[model samples]
Target: MEVTPRRAGMVALLALLPVLAFGIFRTWWAGAITLINVLIIAVSLYLLMSPTEEEAHEAHADNGVENASDEAL
Candidate 1:
């Protein structure tokens, strides 16, 4: 089985869970911030990694609109 970039990233992230858990256990404030930051990063990565069909269609539509405006100018 071939490992994809996303899968590799997830594995790497899982490896860090113990460290994050330790940090949270040591200091509640810093650990909370770290957890939130990690979650934000994960969500951002998820969004960046996938291109939805609607997004593709919207991109094409935007290009068509731009071309139309350029022709009008």
Candidate 2:
């Protein structure tokens, strides 16, 4: 799914939850888990938010290649 502003906000909240829980509960392990989760969420957000123009162009280019090869057959 594309990262709309709402979704991005939700992800930010999700990343924050673990840290908050760790802080409130004094759980070191939770802190580690939170760090890992934040990294994963950050990457997912980046991918979801970035434009897909290159991928779209590549898909169209691949289809053209396939159609040209089919015509030659």
Top lDDT prediction, candidate number: 2
Top-TM-score candidate index: 1
Q: Candidate 2 on 1-73: residue-level lDDT in tens?
A: 6557456746665767768778578878778777777867777776677658997777777843457557889
Deviation in angstroms for 20 in model 2?
4.0
Candidate 1 segments exceeding 4 Å error = 1-19, 54-73
Q: Give per-residue CA lDDT, model 1, range 1-73, as digits (tens).
A: 8554476457546635865876867887777677677766766665666678897787877843456657889
TM-score of each: 0.48, 0.43
Q: What TM value does model 2 have?
A: 0.43
lDDT of each: 0.67, 0.71
Colliding residue pairs in candidate 2 = none
